[model samples]
Target: MQNMRIVKKPGYAVDSVDRALQLILLLQETEWLRIGQAAKALGVAPSTAHRLMSTLVYRGFALQDDQHRYCAGPALHPEPAVGAERALVAAARPHLEALAARVQETVNLVERVGATARYLATVEGPQLLRVGNRAGTILPAHVSAAGKAILSTLPDEMVSAVCARQPPHGGSALTAAEMQELQAELRDVRSRGFAVNLGRTEPDLAAVGAPLASGNRPAALALSISAPLSRARQIQDPAAVEALLTCCAALRLELETQGRL
Candidate 1:
């Protein structure tokens, strides 16, 4: 325990505010937290933890579910600025171009909107039978590789809410069995750190995608390599997955570094 020396600062921290901020950070790291867990983590009494959590809930920084578990609130993920979409596209253009060059396939940057994903930017590959630009097209999130990549990063409840509000575009409502199957696929995507759409969005199209994380937070953005189904067999190829992941990492690093600015 010699390595655990405690330093007492003179005039820096306030205990209550510090504890509240710590709770917020904890919420960021996990899907949900209970009062007992928060109290134990912060070395506070249960009453104190309850008070702190109540304050957060009142201020919209946290939400208390029916089970009394605390989860992050909408306030934690603020809406982007007025022209933020354009800025995102501008920052991502070069990276998308590089990815398309490396993978020899069309690359796209997509943003999640409700239950749909809207293409924000795209870079086409050199292949003659390449997928076309989808810069402004919107598609069902459950059927798009990029959408699945982004969705896999969200909590189950939030995903369910989005699905409930905006069921798939052209199909009958999703049955409970279908929802469970989609959840399983998202779990697989989470485990593999990427997602694939094998002719699900369009019969002739296939793609592989990975989510972009900003620090510890999952961004609403994803990047994908799109191609004709014939060439898209690469979706399952380890080499192709590696290439897509590499590009995703590069883009994530750039976004993180720029965020500091």
Candidate 2:
């Protein structure tokens, strides 16, 4: 991240607790984090950083690599999240199938999680060659089609804050310039009412997605259609977009009626 976005600290915020929480957020953002980087980000001494990380490692919330860099550990993902997602998958199944039938391509449902998007469910297409199921997959929110759509629904400042934490690791990480470009893309997605991914997440694959609402309020859920790069144009067609939006609306309405949204 080129610049640190300002976080409004609560008046009663506990310094040790807050620093530990910030460290957790940092670990969650980057694939790997050096102790020095953590100390710098949290404005704590290197010794304090080590002690903090020791606690996280003890709790299984963080782990150290051979190089001593910190990364997210197993405890970061809890069973409650998976249980809630299972309910979401069941509620959205019919619409996912409908969207898959309409586009005749792989259809996916994703939920935005901080700066990432989690693939909760997918309905594979009938084509001989197509994107397979990505259920339970997690990708950066800025790169995935549905993730962008979900982020577009958030306030601009919130979106910027989310993009600012992009870790400095891997080719998939968005740089400062790339984050700016994503801002521009989100603007178009907001106005166009849908988002597109042209091989951003994976080469030779293209996808389009639209955000959905929960109980009349904007939510972090999106439904997208993925296809082979050769069928990219087909997925972006007006009919495909309409079909996606129609299914999202229907699903949103059903969930709202059932008090599930």
Candidate 3:
């Protein structure tokens, strides 16, 4: 975190542009914003707020739902997960269970929190020698299977912004060369539709992961399956990959049904 605070606006800032962006920020914070609420927040008239939001809707940055309340639009959200991570995880549990059962490995639901991937849920497989549950575990996004999997879906500049920070557990920031290497790996992940971590997180653990929804908007969450390194190959086998992708399809539909995709 920075040590000192800078003013919200510089002396030469443009008021209209700043206000428009402020409305966007407000939409990010609030699940559904009303015109009156926006006006109250911006210190502007209701009509002015409506006009500004209407313009946002026209540009696909905001949406006016059937209730005439405003919400962040596809262009602005792309993932529908601002302040909704818990809901998304709740919807994903069943699918994770199905995947774990099918693959007989530990399944993890990971949310990308800046440069770290926080495990939201986990389902352990039945094998005697299997990867343990990781619900609530946090790992460097760059070094995590699910994290790298989701990062592959973003643009290079955005990836840089995400991995530009230090690891959540405490470490130096990623260097430029490391970012380049990770970007290269991400390019491969994008083409393959999955990512792998071979004993990267633990000495005896290996995993495979992919974005929650492929060929669509970027997802804030990813699904991964882990197994003991001695038997990790099974998780990457064709059957496991097929099961994982099939589960992703089902989970994506659930999210869409909830208006979260």
Candidate 4:
């Protein structure tokens, strides 16, 4: 006769509260969850799961879509702005270094702050004519590859709002015509999956940049490679573009896997 094994169910010390907390954690990681799915996962009745979800929604800890699926709410992620920025820079540093080495050009990690792009981290290349370290520098977003790349991922209305509030410094004041031109350029950036700066921000300097997707939200961060115009001929080359995209993709994956995104 063959031996048979039986599985036993474990009892929870405080089932309802434990299940509710578990649901919150689940919603954080998942795109959406249905009550039935939650009940099954928690080994509870569907009605019990529904009540828990309703409480979470009432408290602004979860949101239900038109389809009645639940997703994470704003309250679940309340990290302060400065803390978030530091975390983003810490997560991007290694990838930026690797990309700089591969492209033989300076690499920067920047985040959009109002109408400016703040350079949070930078890695200088080995080349003699490479761009200088841009860490701690802030530049007008409309004229920067990293800033343009991030802006390209945002809604048009939000981009318009930012532009209307702050014009690029020491450059032509933004007029309606200039805004239209910028919109066209952003469209091209979205289509090409990257943005380019051709001596726009700084003379004889160029860069190519791509936005870093933040899981379910619009990208707030970007990565870019900068080089002197003499060596920037390869900016649009297949290898250089591939390296930039590949590096950004890897960085995004790492952030998502670490539950930081």
**Alpha-carbon runs more than 4 Å astray in model 1:** 1-82, 167-172
Question: Which has the greatest TM-score?
Answer: 2
Runs of candidate 4 exceeding 4 Å displacement = 1-84, 167-173, 214-216
Model 2 bad stretches (over 4 Å): 1-81, 167-174, 214-216
The TM-score obtained by model 3 is 0.66
Candidate 4: tens digits of C-alpha lDDT, residues 1-261: 998888554574577788889999889888878999999988889999999988887555676542467777655878695566667778888898899889888999987877877677789998887898666556788889999999998888888888777433323446898889999999999889899999987789999989997544688789999999777778778899999999999998998888776
lDDT of each: 0.80, 0.82, 0.81, 0.82
Candidate 2, residues 1-61: lDDT per residue as tens digits?
5998898988999899999999999988988888899999999899999889878875557
Q: For model 3, how does the per-residue alpha-carbon lDDT over 147-252 read when each residue is reduced to its tens digit?
A: 8988988899999988897654456888889989999999999888889999887888899888876465677878899988987788889889878878877887
> Per-candidate TM vs. native?
0.65, 0.67, 0.66, 0.65
After superposition, the stretches of candidate 3 with alpha carbons farther than 4 Å from their true spots are 1-86, 214-216
Poorest 10 consecutive residues of model 4 by lDDT? 165-174
Each candidate structure's count of clashing pairs: 0, 0, 0, 0
User: If the candidates were sorted by their lDDT against the true structure, best first, what order would they fall in?
Assistant: 2, 4, 3, 1
Winner by TM-score between candidate 2 and candidate 1: 2
